[model samples]
Target: MSPLIALRAFDDSINSNSSVDGVSVVKIIEYVVIGIVVLSLLALGYMGWRHRYNLKLLGEAIAHRKEKHALAHGRRTKDVQ
Candidate 1:
């Protein structure tokens, strides 16, 4: 082949290879971003679940206190009889 033809072929090859590399790099970045988002969401969900559990425990404790007070009051009244 002529020198000019050989140079043209080399340039075309380089361009195609660069384009492929660029696409691969973009795909890698996309996957990384997706992974980060998923992890953040999971962390937020766990925190929310923990907060709700604490609230439930607090409510149960309050209910128990009320019941105990009522029982104590009833016992005092009976003893006065």
Candidate 2:
């Protein structure tokens, strides 16, 4: 027999023996689990972005405060001399 005919026969044998109901249920559950994992990762990425932005804002505020303090201290010393 040809290769195509041999493959068709093998497929027919497999289909005849396998049950469809249990396989469909298992496939549905597997897809749901995969979707949950993908959604969890997306949530984690959003939280990380928010945390980084907050840290950047805090650092800028601290730097500005330090500069203002230094300028005021310098003027006080100049007046005394």
lDDT of each: 0.69, 0.67
User: After best superposition, candidate 2 residue 60: deviation in angstroms?
Assistant: 0.8
Q: Which stretches of candidate 2 lie over 4 Å from their true place?
A: 1-23, 75-81
Model 1, 31: alpha-carbon shift in Å?
Answer: 0.8
Q: Could you tell me which residue pairs clash in candidate 2? A: none
TM-score per candidate = 0.53, 0.53
Q: For candidate 1, what's the RMSD?
A: 13.8
Worst 10 residues of 1 by lDDT: 72-81
Q: Check candidate 1 and list the clashing pairs.
A: none
The TM-score that candidate 2 achieves is 0.53
What lDDT is reached at residue 62 by model 2?
Answer: 86
Give the Cα error of residue 78 in candidate 2, in Å.
18
Worst lDDT window (10 residues) for model 2? Answer: 72-81
The runs of at least 3 residues in candidate 1 whose Cα sits more than 4 Å from the true structure, single-residue gaps closed, are 1-23, 73-81
